[model samples]
Target: MKILTLHGINLNMFGKRDPKQYGTATLAQIDDQLRALGQELGAEVECFQTNFEGEMAERIHRAHTDGTDAVIINAGAWTHYSYGLRDALAILKCPIIEVHMSNIHAREAFRHVSVIAEIARGQIAGFGVDSYLLGLRAAVSAVQQG
Candidate 1:
Protein backbone atom coordinates (compact mmCIF):
# COMPACT_ATOMS: atom_id res chain seq x y z
CA MET A 1 0.00 0.00 0.00
CA LYS A 2 1.11 3.53 -0.64
CA ILE A 3 0.73 6.02 2.20
CA LEU A 4 1.40 9.72 1.96
CA THR A 5 2.18 11.73 5.08
CA LEU A 6 1.70 15.48 4.98
CA HIS A 7 3.27 17.87 7.48
CA GLY A 8 2.36 21.48 7.17
CA ILE A 9 3.48 25.03 7.99
CA ASN A 10 5.84 25.68 10.92
CA LEU A 11 6.08 21.95 11.51
CA ASN A 12 9.50 22.01 9.95
CA MET A 13 10.53 23.54 13.26
CA PHE A 14 9.52 20.43 15.15
CA GLY A 15 12.72 20.19 17.15
CA LYS A 16 13.60 23.83 17.70
CA ARG A 17 10.14 25.39 17.78
CA ASP A 18 8.81 24.28 21.14
CA PRO A 19 10.01 21.38 23.23
CA LYS A 20 7.07 21.75 25.58
CA GLN A 21 4.38 20.71 23.10
CA TYR A 22 6.15 19.45 19.98
CA GLY A 23 9.01 17.62 21.71
CA THR A 24 12.61 17.50 20.47
CA ALA A 25 12.16 15.23 17.45
CA THR A 26 13.27 16.90 14.27
CA LEU A 27 11.03 16.61 11.23
CA ALA A 28 13.55 14.27 9.69
CA GLN A 29 13.50 12.07 12.77
CA ILE A 30 9.71 11.97 12.72
CA ASP A 31 9.76 11.03 9.04
CA ASP A 32 12.27 8.29 9.76
CA GLN A 33 10.03 6.87 12.45
CA LEU A 34 7.02 6.94 10.12
CA ARG A 35 8.95 5.27 7.32
CA ALA A 36 10.18 2.54 9.64
CA LEU A 37 6.69 1.90 10.95
CA GLY A 38 5.28 1.95 7.43
CA GLN A 39 7.75 -0.73 6.42
CA GLU A 40 6.64 -2.92 9.28
CA LEU A 41 3.03 -2.31 8.28
CA GLY A 42 3.76 -3.42 4.73
CA ALA A 43 3.11 0.00 3.32
CA GLU A 44 5.37 2.38 1.42
CA VAL A 45 5.38 5.76 3.15
CA GLU A 46 6.13 8.96 1.31
CA CYS A 47 6.44 12.08 3.44
CA PHE A 48 6.07 15.68 2.33
CA GLN A 49 6.43 18.85 4.39
CA THR A 50 5.73 22.36 3.23
CA ASN A 51 5.41 25.75 4.86
CA PHE A 52 3.41 26.99 1.89
CA GLU A 53 -0.29 26.36 1.63
CA GLY A 54 -0.33 26.34 -2.16
CA GLU A 55 2.42 23.77 -2.32
CA MET A 56 0.55 21.55 0.10
CA ALA A 57 -2.62 21.81 -1.92
CA GLU A 58 -0.68 20.96 -5.04
CA ARG A 59 0.81 17.91 -3.35
CA ILE A 60 -2.66 16.75 -2.40
CA HIS A 61 -3.68 17.15 -6.03
CA ARG A 62 -0.76 14.99 -7.02
CA ALA A 63 -1.73 12.35 -4.49
CA HIS A 64 -5.04 12.00 -6.28
CA THR A 65 -3.29 10.89 -9.47
CA ASP A 66 -0.40 9.13 -7.69
CA GLY A 67 -2.61 6.26 -6.52
CA THR A 68 -2.04 6.90 -2.84
CA ASP A 69 -3.96 4.38 -0.72
CA ALA A 70 -4.13 6.49 2.40
CA VAL A 71 -3.08 9.85 3.84
CA ILE A 72 -1.94 10.89 7.31
CA ILE A 73 -1.80 14.62 7.86
CA ASN A 74 -0.74 17.04 10.59
CA ALA A 75 -1.62 20.39 9.06
CA GLY A 76 -0.47 22.55 12.02
CA ALA A 77 -2.35 25.85 12.25
CA TRP A 78 -3.76 25.21 8.81
CA THR A 79 -5.93 22.50 10.26
CA HIS A 80 -8.10 25.19 11.73
CA TYR A 81 -8.73 27.21 8.58
CA SER A 82 -7.19 25.82 5.39
CA TYR A 83 -10.24 25.18 3.27
CA GLY A 84 -7.96 24.90 0.27
CA LEU A 85 -6.11 21.99 1.80
CA ARG A 86 -9.34 20.38 2.95
CA ASP A 87 -10.80 20.74 -0.49
CA ALA A 88 -7.69 19.26 -2.04
CA LEU A 89 -7.92 16.32 0.33
CA ALA A 90 -11.57 15.92 -0.54
CA ILE A 91 -10.48 15.02 -4.04
CA LEU A 92 -8.85 11.85 -2.85
CA LYS A 93 -10.70 8.52 -2.77
CA CYS A 94 -8.56 7.10 0.01
CA PRO A 95 -8.84 7.31 3.74
CA ILE A 96 -7.64 10.56 5.32
CA ILE A 97 -6.40 10.46 8.91
CA GLU A 98 -5.67 13.70 10.74
CA VAL A 99 -3.06 13.80 13.48
CA HIS A 100 -1.59 16.20 16.02
CA MET A 101 1.38 15.98 18.35
CA SER A 102 -0.31 18.04 21.03
CA ASN A 103 -3.91 17.85 22.05
CA ILE A 104 -5.38 20.73 20.14
CA HIS A 105 -8.57 20.65 22.17
CA ALA A 106 -6.52 20.98 25.33
CA ARG A 107 -4.67 24.00 24.01
CA GLU A 108 -5.92 27.42 23.09
CA ALA A 109 -9.56 28.03 22.14
CA PHE A 110 -8.65 28.70 18.55
CA ARG A 111 -6.74 25.43 18.35
CA HIS A 112 -9.79 23.46 19.40
CA VAL A 113 -11.39 23.63 15.98
CA SER A 114 -10.37 21.58 12.94
CA VAL A 115 -11.82 22.39 9.56
CA ILE A 116 -10.32 19.21 8.20
CA ALA A 117 -11.99 16.98 10.75
CA GLU A 118 -15.32 16.92 8.95
CA ILE A 119 -13.69 15.56 5.81
CA ALA A 120 -11.23 13.20 7.47
CA ARG A 121 -11.93 9.55 8.11
CA GLY A 122 -10.77 10.01 11.69
CA GLN A 123 -8.29 11.85 13.95
CA ILE A 124 -5.51 11.04 16.41
CA ALA A 125 -3.79 13.36 18.85
CA GLY A 126 -2.28 14.01 22.30
CA PHE A 127 0.34 11.28 22.20
CA GLY A 128 3.16 13.21 20.59
CA VAL A 129 4.85 11.27 17.75
CA ASP A 130 2.71 8.29 18.53
CA SER A 131 -0.20 10.17 17.04
CA TYR A 132 1.41 9.91 13.63
CA LEU A 133 2.00 6.23 14.01
CA LEU A 134 -1.53 5.67 15.18
CA GLY A 135 -2.87 7.72 12.31
CA LEU A 136 -0.88 5.61 9.89
CA ARG A 137 -2.22 2.44 11.43
CA ALA A 138 -5.73 3.83 11.22
CA ALA A 139 -5.31 4.67 7.59
CA VAL A 140 -3.93 1.26 6.75
CA SER A 141 -6.66 -0.46 8.67
CA ALA A 142 -9.29 1.60 6.96
CA VAL A 143 -7.89 0.72 3.58
CA GLN A 144 -7.73 -2.96 4.45
CA GLN A 145 -11.25 -3.00 5.79
CA GLY A 146 -12.62 -1.40 2.68
Candidate 2:
Protein backbone atom coordinates (compact mmCIF):
# COMPACT_ATOMS: atom_id res chain seq x y z
CA MET A 1 0.00 0.00 0.00
CA LYS A 2 1.08 3.58 -0.64
CA ILE A 3 0.47 6.09 2.16
CA LEU A 4 0.88 9.84 2.20
CA THR A 5 1.58 11.53 5.52
CA LEU A 6 0.96 15.25 5.83
CA HIS A 7 2.38 17.31 8.67
CA GLY A 8 0.99 20.78 8.94
CA ILE A 9 1.86 24.22 10.28
CA ASN A 10 4.24 24.85 13.16
CA LEU A 11 4.79 21.09 13.24
CA ASN A 12 8.03 21.61 11.38
CA MET A 13 9.32 23.03 14.64
CA PHE A 14 8.22 19.91 16.52
CA GLY A 15 10.79 19.14 19.20
CA LYS A 16 11.70 22.78 19.66
CA ARG A 17 8.13 24.00 19.64
CA ASP A 18 6.96 22.43 22.88
CA PRO A 19 8.91 19.51 24.31
CA LYS A 20 6.30 18.94 26.95
CA GLN A 21 3.50 18.49 24.45
CA TYR A 22 5.11 17.33 21.21
CA GLY A 23 7.91 15.27 22.75
CA THR A 24 11.65 15.52 22.12
CA ALA A 25 11.82 14.03 18.64
CA THR A 26 12.41 16.34 15.72
CA LEU A 27 10.12 16.16 12.70
CA ALA A 28 12.83 14.53 10.60
CA GLN A 29 13.49 11.92 13.25
CA ILE A 30 9.81 11.09 13.47
CA ASP A 31 9.57 10.83 9.70
CA ASP A 32 12.52 8.46 9.60
CA GLN A 33 10.88 6.26 12.19
CA LEU A 34 7.62 6.26 10.25
CA ARG A 35 9.45 5.43 7.06
CA ALA A 36 11.18 2.49 8.70
CA LEU A 37 7.92 1.26 10.18
CA GLY A 38 6.29 1.52 6.76
CA GLN A 39 9.06 -0.57 5.25
CA GLU A 40 8.65 -3.18 7.93
CA LEU A 41 4.97 -3.35 7.14
CA GLY A 42 5.65 -3.67 3.41
CA ALA A 43 4.06 -0.35 2.60
CA GLU A 44 5.36 2.71 0.75
CA VAL A 45 5.11 5.83 2.91
CA GLU A 46 5.62 9.33 1.49
CA CYS A 47 5.76 12.29 3.87
CA PHE A 48 5.16 16.02 3.41
CA GLN A 49 5.35 18.88 5.91
CA THR A 50 4.25 22.45 5.27
CA ASN A 51 3.71 25.54 7.37
CA PHE A 52 1.36 26.94 4.74
CA GLU A 53 -2.29 26.01 4.56
CA GLY A 54 -2.59 26.32 0.78
CA GLU A 55 0.43 24.12 0.21
CA MET A 56 -0.98 21.46 2.50
CA ALA A 57 -4.31 21.56 0.72
CA GLU A 58 -2.61 21.30 -2.67
CA ARG A 59 -0.66 18.29 -1.45
CA ILE A 60 -3.84 16.59 -0.35
CA HIS A 61 -5.44 17.33 -3.69
CA ARG A 62 -2.39 15.89 -5.39
CA ALA A 63 -2.61 12.66 -3.42
CA HIS A 64 -5.47 11.44 -5.62
CA THR A 65 -3.27 11.68 -8.66
CA ASP A 66 -0.16 10.38 -6.94
CA GLY A 67 -1.55 6.85 -6.57
CA THR A 68 -1.78 7.13 -2.80
CA ASP A 69 -3.89 4.41 -1.21
CA ALA A 70 -4.52 6.29 2.01
CA VAL A 71 -3.48 9.38 3.98
CA ILE A 72 -2.53 10.20 7.57
CA ILE A 73 -2.69 13.90 8.34
CA ASN A 74 -1.70 15.97 11.38
CA ALA A 75 -2.93 19.43 10.45
CA GLY A 76 -1.51 21.13 13.53
CA ALA A 77 -3.42 24.32 14.35
CA TRP A 78 -5.33 23.90 11.12
CA THR A 79 -7.20 21.03 12.76
CA HIS A 80 -9.28 23.51 14.70
CA TYR A 81 -10.22 25.50 11.63
CA SER A 82 -9.28 25.54 7.92
CA TYR A 83 -12.42 24.32 6.24
CA GLY A 84 -10.41 24.29 3.02
CA LEU A 85 -8.24 21.50 4.37
CA ARG A 86 -11.31 19.68 5.53
CA ASP A 87 -12.84 20.07 2.09
CA ALA A 88 -9.73 18.79 0.40
CA LEU A 89 -9.83 15.75 2.66
CA ALA A 90 -13.47 15.25 1.92
CA ILE A 91 -12.63 15.00 -1.76
CA LEU A 92 -10.12 12.21 -1.34
CA LYS A 93 -11.47 8.77 -2.17
CA CYS A 94 -9.13 6.97 0.22
CA PRO A 95 -9.23 6.54 3.94
CA ILE A 96 -7.86 9.47 5.99
CA ILE A 97 -6.83 9.28 9.64
CA GLU A 98 -6.49 12.60 11.44
CA VAL A 99 -3.70 12.59 14.01
CA HIS A 100 -2.36 14.95 16.68
CA MET A 101 0.65 14.76 18.98
CA SER A 102 -1.28 16.24 21.88
CA ASN A 103 -4.79 15.40 22.89
CA ILE A 104 -6.69 18.41 21.58
CA HIS A 105 -9.69 17.67 23.71
CA ALA A 106 -7.55 18.08 26.80
CA ARG A 107 -5.72 21.15 25.57
CA GLU A 108 -6.94 24.68 24.98
CA ALA A 109 -10.64 25.15 24.44
CA PHE A 110 -9.97 26.05 20.80
CA ARG A 111 -8.01 22.86 20.10
CA HIS A 112 -10.95 20.68 20.93
CA VAL A 113 -12.60 21.28 17.57
CA SER A 114 -11.12 19.62 14.50
CA VAL A 115 -12.55 20.49 11.09
CA ILE A 116 -10.81 17.52 9.48
CA ALA A 117 -12.21 15.06 11.97
CA GLU A 118 -15.63 15.47 10.42
CA ILE A 119 -14.34 13.92 7.19
CA ALA A 120 -11.72 11.50 8.47
CA ARG A 121 -12.28 7.79 8.93
CA GLY A 122 -10.89 8.18 12.45
CA GLN A 123 -8.82 10.43 14.71
CA ILE A 124 -5.75 9.51 16.80
CA ALA A 125 -4.37 11.82 19.45
CA GLY A 126 -2.61 12.16 22.84
CA PHE A 127 -0.17 9.32 22.07
CA GLY A 128 2.56 11.75 21.04
CA VAL A 129 4.61 10.51 18.04
CA ASP A 130 2.86 7.16 18.35
CA SER A 131 -0.27 8.85 17.06
CA TYR A 132 1.28 9.10 13.61
CA LEU A 133 2.48 5.50 13.72
CA LEU A 134 -0.92 4.29 14.83
CA GLY A 135 -2.57 6.38 12.12
CA LEU A 136 -0.26 4.87 9.52
CA ARG A 137 -1.05 1.37 10.74
CA ALA A 138 -4.76 2.10 10.61
CA ALA A 139 -4.42 3.51 7.08
CA VAL A 140 -2.63 0.35 5.93
CA SER A 141 -5.29 -1.85 7.52
CA ALA A 142 -8.11 0.18 6.00
CA VAL A 143 -6.62 -0.25 2.53
CA GLN A 144 -6.13 -3.98 3.03
CA GLN A 145 -9.68 -4.42 4.25
CA GLY A 146 -11.11 -2.56 1.31
Candidate 3:
Protein backbone atom coordinates (compact mmCIF):
# COMPACT_ATOMS: atom_id res chain seq x y z
CA MET A 1 0.00 0.00 0.00
CA LYS A 2 1.07 3.56 -0.65
CA ILE A 3 0.44 6.17 2.02
CA LEU A 4 1.12 9.87 2.17
CA THR A 5 1.71 11.70 5.44
CA LEU A 6 1.06 15.45 5.42
CA HIS A 7 2.47 17.77 8.06
CA GLY A 8 1.44 21.39 7.88
CA ILE A 9 2.17 24.85 9.27
CA ASN A 10 4.66 24.96 12.16
CA LEU A 11 5.17 21.24 12.38
CA ASN A 12 8.73 21.64 11.18
CA MET A 13 9.34 23.26 14.55
CA PHE A 14 8.38 20.15 16.47
CA GLY A 15 11.51 19.61 18.51
CA LYS A 16 12.10 23.30 19.16
CA ARG A 17 8.59 24.46 19.97
CA ASP A 18 6.90 23.78 23.30
CA PRO A 19 8.48 20.58 24.46
CA LYS A 20 5.76 20.42 27.10
CA GLN A 21 3.17 19.86 24.41
CA TYR A 22 5.10 18.33 21.52
CA GLY A 23 7.89 15.90 22.20
CA THR A 24 11.58 16.49 21.53
CA ALA A 25 11.59 14.54 18.28
CA THR A 26 12.43 16.65 15.27
CA LEU A 27 10.17 16.62 12.24
CA ALA A 28 12.66 14.56 10.26
CA GLN A 29 12.92 12.10 13.11
CA ILE A 30 9.16 11.73 13.20
CA ASP A 31 9.00 11.15 9.46
CA ASP A 32 11.80 8.63 9.58
CA GLN A 33 10.01 6.72 12.29
CA LEU A 34 6.77 6.75 10.30
CA ARG A 35 8.58 5.50 7.21
CA ALA A 36 10.24 2.75 9.20
CA LEU A 37 6.91 1.76 10.73
CA GLY A 38 5.31 1.82 7.32
CA GLN A 39 7.88 -0.62 6.03
CA GLU A 40 7.10 -2.94 8.88
CA LEU A 41 3.47 -2.85 7.89
CA GLY A 42 4.24 -3.50 4.22
CA ALA A 43 3.36 -0.02 3.03
CA GLU A 44 5.24 2.63 1.11
CA VAL A 45 5.14 5.93 3.00
CA GLU A 46 5.88 9.37 1.64
CA CYS A 47 5.96 12.38 3.96
CA PHE A 48 5.53 16.07 3.06
CA GLN A 49 5.68 19.14 5.26
CA THR A 50 5.07 22.80 4.48
CA ASN A 51 4.35 26.08 6.18
CA PHE A 52 2.24 27.15 3.19
CA GLU A 53 -1.36 26.08 3.03
CA GLY A 54 -1.51 26.45 -0.74
CA GLU A 55 1.47 24.21 -1.19
CA MET A 56 -0.10 21.59 1.05
CA ALA A 57 -3.33 21.76 -0.93
CA GLU A 58 -1.40 21.36 -4.16
CA ARG A 59 0.33 18.32 -2.77
CA ILE A 60 -3.02 16.80 -1.87
CA HIS A 61 -4.19 17.44 -5.43
CA ARG A 62 -1.17 15.62 -6.74
CA ALA A 63 -1.92 12.69 -4.48
CA HIS A 64 -5.38 12.41 -5.97
CA THR A 65 -3.88 11.27 -9.25
CA ASP A 66 -0.73 9.73 -7.83
CA GLY A 67 -2.39 6.43 -6.85
CA THR A 68 -2.00 7.10 -3.13
CA ASP A 69 -3.89 4.45 -1.19
CA ALA A 70 -4.49 6.46 1.97
CA VAL A 71 -3.42 9.58 3.85
CA ILE A 72 -2.34 10.41 7.39
CA ILE A 73 -2.37 14.13 8.15
CA ASN A 74 -1.33 16.26 11.09
CA ALA A 75 -2.23 19.65 9.66
CA GLY A 76 -1.07 21.56 12.77
CA ALA A 77 -2.97 24.84 13.22
CA TRP A 78 -4.59 24.24 9.85
CA THR A 79 -6.71 21.63 11.57
CA HIS A 80 -8.57 24.43 13.29
CA TYR A 81 -9.22 26.59 10.22
CA SER A 82 -8.06 25.48 6.78
CA TYR A 83 -11.12 24.81 4.67
CA GLY A 84 -9.02 24.85 1.52
CA LEU A 85 -7.02 21.96 2.88
CA ARG A 86 -10.16 20.21 4.02
CA ASP A 87 -11.78 20.56 0.60
CA ALA A 88 -8.61 19.39 -1.08
CA LEU A 89 -8.64 16.31 1.10
CA ALA A 90 -12.32 15.75 0.39
CA ILE A 91 -11.46 15.06 -3.23
CA LEU A 92 -9.67 11.89 -2.27
CA LYS A 93 -11.72 8.69 -2.34
CA CYS A 94 -9.23 6.90 -0.13
CA PRO A 95 -9.41 6.95 3.62
CA ILE A 96 -7.88 9.87 5.53
CA ILE A 97 -6.94 9.93 9.20
CA GLU A 98 -6.38 13.29 10.85
CA VAL A 99 -3.77 13.21 13.60
CA HIS A 100 -2.50 15.62 16.24
CA MET A 101 0.63 15.38 18.37
CA SER A 102 -1.04 17.23 21.19
CA ASN A 103 -4.56 16.74 22.39
CA ILE A 104 -6.51 19.58 20.90
CA HIS A 105 -9.48 19.05 23.13
CA ALA A 106 -7.46 19.61 26.25
CA ARG A 107 -5.85 22.76 24.97
CA GLU A 108 -7.17 26.27 24.60
CA ALA A 109 -10.67 26.84 23.28
CA PHE A 110 -9.36 27.83 19.86
CA ARG A 111 -7.69 24.47 19.43
CA HIS A 112 -10.74 22.36 20.18
CA VAL A 113 -12.33 22.49 16.77
CA SER A 114 -11.09 20.76 13.65
CA VAL A 115 -11.99 21.70 10.09
CA ILE A 116 -10.74 18.40 8.72
CA ALA A 117 -12.45 15.99 11.10
CA GLU A 118 -15.78 15.85 9.30
CA ILE A 119 -14.15 14.66 6.09
CA ALA A 120 -11.71 12.27 7.64
CA ARG A 121 -12.37 8.59 8.16
CA GLY A 122 -11.36 9.13 11.79
CA GLN A 123 -8.96 11.04 14.00
CA ILE A 124 -6.11 10.21 16.38
CA ALA A 125 -4.64 12.68 18.78
CA GLY A 126 -2.87 13.37 22.10
CA PHE A 127 -0.21 10.72 21.76
CA GLY A 128 2.70 12.76 20.50
CA VAL A 129 4.43 11.15 17.50
CA ASP A 130 2.64 7.97 18.30
CA SER A 131 -0.52 9.63 17.06
CA TYR A 132 0.96 9.70 13.58
CA LEU A 133 1.98 6.11 13.85
CA LEU A 134 -1.51 5.12 14.96
CA GLY A 135 -3.04 7.17 12.20
CA LEU A 136 -0.86 5.41 9.67
CA ARG A 137 -1.80 2.06 11.08
CA ALA A 138 -5.48 2.98 11.04
CA ALA A 139 -5.31 4.23 7.46
CA VAL A 140 -3.47 1.12 6.31
CA SER A 141 -5.85 -1.10 8.19
CA ALA A 142 -8.84 0.64 6.66
CA VAL A 143 -7.38 0.31 3.19
CA GLN A 144 -6.69 -3.36 3.68
CA GLN A 145 -10.17 -4.04 5.01
CA GLY A 146 -11.76 -2.40 2.01
Pairs of residues at least 3 apart in sequence or in different chains that clash in candidate 3:
none
lDDT of 2: 0.92
Candidate 1 lDDT, 1-146, residue by residue in tens: 99999999999999999899989999999999999999999999999999999999999999999889999999999999999999999989999999999999999999999999998999999999999999999998999998
Off by over 4 Å in 1: none
TM-score of each model, paired residue for residue: 0.98, 0.98, 0.99
For candidate 1, the per-residue lDDT at 39 reads: 94
Kindly give the stretch of ten consecutive residues in candidate 2 with the minimal lDDT sum: 57-66
Query: Residues 1-146, candidate 2, lDDT per residue (tens digit)?
Result: 89999999999898898899999999999899899999998899999999988999899989978899999999999899899999988989999999999999999999999988888999999999999999999999999999
lDDT by candidate, in order shown: 0.95, 0.92, 0.96
RMSD of each: 0.6, 0.6, 0.5
Error of 1 at 35 (Å): 0.5
For candidate 3, lDDT tens digit of each residue in 1-146? Answer: 99999999999999999999998999999999999999999999999999999999999999999999999999999999999999999999999999999999999999999999999999998999999999999999999998
